[model samples]
Target chain A: MTVRSGAAARSGARGRPGAGGRPGGVARLVVRTVSEVCVTAGTLIVLFVVYVLFWTGVRADSAMDGEIGKLQDQWSTGPVAAGTPGATGGQPSGPGKQPPYENGKSFAVMYIPRFGADWSKPVLEGTAVDVLKKGLGHYGRTARLGETGNFAVAGHRRTYGDPFKDFPRLRPGDAVVLTDGTTWFTYRIDRRPYRTLPTDIGVIDPVPRESGYSGPGRYLTLTTCEPEWGHSHRLIAWAHLDSTQPVERGRPSALTG
Target chain B: MYGWIWRHLPGNAWVKALVSLVLVLAIVYVLFQYVFPWAEPLLPFNDVTVDRGMGAVR
Candidate 1:
């Protein structure tokens, strides 16, 4: 009986070690748990980066396409007829008489031939996050299209399809073409890209003091985040009214060239 | 830590494994949905923009 009891005690001792109550065993377990947590955190960060860089672009492209389709449908219904007041050979309408554009609504398409032959994006009203997610967003209180003030627009430089990723490539004399289903307004790039602070609302002023223009005139301001992947500052390109042509006149030489 | 959990858990190895998986999943979900979002502002991701006045400077 003594021998049998000793055997039982030995078995109990073995089982206790396997139960992980020993100090070394606990330490190993703690290390393993911490490693697992680190692995999980790393994976989550990678997933977030993928969502921000790729998934957001996919979503924005689809949204912009849909907005463009709607705008084209509206234009095709009856507004494109020749001799319409707004469609009359791209003449700039009087101040405050341009076609009404609703906030958060897409009203035009912007094409940058210098960016790419097929580089086109919808221009929506308002610079809000939601509006920008769809495509280029117009500063709400800025000048209307082809107006005698700064028709300022903003787009993301690195995400949401990165509509202005090639903004730095723009040079003086490059054309920034905009169309509102009736008239094609072409603005000649007048100033190279320059950096500015985010709070510089004057960049979109009727007469952008920074553009070296002391008097009010027709202007266009294209703004985007600088440093490609960072928004620490804004990169702006200024343009002046070059010409206007009706859509019925076919694609402009700036677009075709 | 795992050994203590293993000894305290009821049932067989399968039960312990299932319980551990559930615990891990709950921890991950809480960290992602609550902890990470709450900690975002403390990070530098959204610190890109500066609110200084508009001056044309690089």
Candidate 2:
């Protein structure tokens, strides 16, 4: 009986308490739970970063392609007249006289040779986030293409194909070409990218107060986020109207160069 | 805690693993679809503009 009782006592000690009642068991449980939570949170943060940086670019590229196709179809159906002032070999046209574009409507395609030979993105009216996601967005209050005053545009530098990813590489006299299905408007980069505040609306002024120009003239302003990944500040590049050419005249010297 | 969970859990090791996976997925889905979306605007991710000496720009 004594041997049997000792065996039973040992079994009891091993069976239940050893499984759940060990000293510091609660502390171990707490530490394990906290660590698991941290690991889960860390994984989630990584996934979110991937979604923002990589997935957005994929979605934006496809959307931009669709917008370009639609613009091409529209232009093909209603080709602009040849030999107009806005066309090749024609004289410079007057200001604010070109066709009016509706809000969110795509009116032209912008090319920055510094970006790449095949780099072109649709220019759509409005600076709304949704609009910029599709492609480069034109400031609604700014001047029209090839017109007097500041024709300002904005785009993302990090996501949505990062249209302005190489904006900083643009040097003075670099070409920023735009086409409205009829004529090509070439603007020469007059200033390298300058850092500015987002509220500095003066950068998009008729004369662009920040551009150091006091008088009204045909100016182009390109704005994007600084640091490539963050939007805490804006990087702006200023340009002036240099020339105009028709599609029939073929690509401009700026494009060829 | 894990030992307690193991003891309470029914069936074999595979059953426990599958249940744990499903539970983890449910928690992640809830956090992503509801908690994170609700908390995003409160974060600073949308503050695209800096406050220059002049004032807030954006």
Candidate 3:
């Protein structure tokens, strides 16, 4: 909003040079160019902030919704062959079974009542950068839905639809439900989110020592960046499988409620 | 700098204004569509993964 910037500066510069003659022209032009450059850089930085804080959310909302819709369409057309290629036709969560979902492809949808009744995000197979841009990502090496060991998932805490934006709102008994077209798996949180360094990979181990579980059991790990918009640390939450029901038996009460 | 561009914009006041607006919008579009997407991965906001690939554990 400076009066001496932008289009207005042209006339000002032309007239102002008359006061000092040609000697001031070169210095005036240099100062003007430097100021213009500074202003343009400032504008770009502000635009980048807008793109990160707002435009990204806009793009990610649609991307996540598109992924969810694609999964639903695939599930409706061919429930068995849609995902879990080898473990088709029957329940895919057979204790030791690993529902080897296609990498970068969404295989399930997760719903957290603590976030909101309508809050749901597709769970992709891998945690790679592009994969998470669509929605939540299932840690490839972790347990599959309702299976033994740790069924861990990761999601954005700030952008990319902010699937776990309210991750800290989770309570000890809050329900985290997910479905893989054939069954609904509900897990209850063991505690609120625990803040830790980004290097704490053991929090997703089969028997996470920090999760209060002394033995191996069906566990769920949710991870996101700490400090909301900062990734200097991570926020983790552990849950244990509470129950499972066939998809035909209707959605688990955890979701319907 | 902007003053020079405005002087050479070759139009009436209204047309020059329209052209300037379009140019600015085009630059923003490219930034949002191409530049921002490419730069996002370089930022820390999207680092949700536990970095198991780094072999850094605590």
Candidate 2 displacement at residue A168 in angstroms: 1.8
lDDT digits (tens) for residues A140-163 of candidate 2 = 777877766778888877766778
In candidate 2, which residue ranges exceed 4 Å CA deviation? A1-23, A79-100, B1-58
Each model's lDDT comes to 0.77, 0.76, 0.83
Chain A TM-score for each of the predictions: 0.86, 0.83, 0.85
Arrange candidates, best lDDT first: 3, 1, 2
Residues A1-257, model 1: lDDT tens digits: 99999999999877887776786676877899998779877988876676567766788899999998988898989556344233454455676665556889998999989999999999998776667778888877778887778888888777678788889999999999999888888889987898987777678788986898878777999888777766567888999978888887988899997
- Give candidate 1 regions above 4 Å deviation: A1-21, A78-94, B1-58
Ranking by DockQ: 3, 2, 1
* Alpha-carbon lDDT of model 2: 0.76
Docking quality band of candidate 2, CAPRI definitions = incorrect
In model 3 chain B, the worst 10-residue window by lDDT is: B49-58
> Where does the lowest 10-residue lDDT sum fall in candidate 2 chain A?
A81-90
- In angstroms, give how far residue B1 of model 2 lies from its true place: 9.8
TM-score of the second chain of model 3 compared to its true counterpart: 0.80
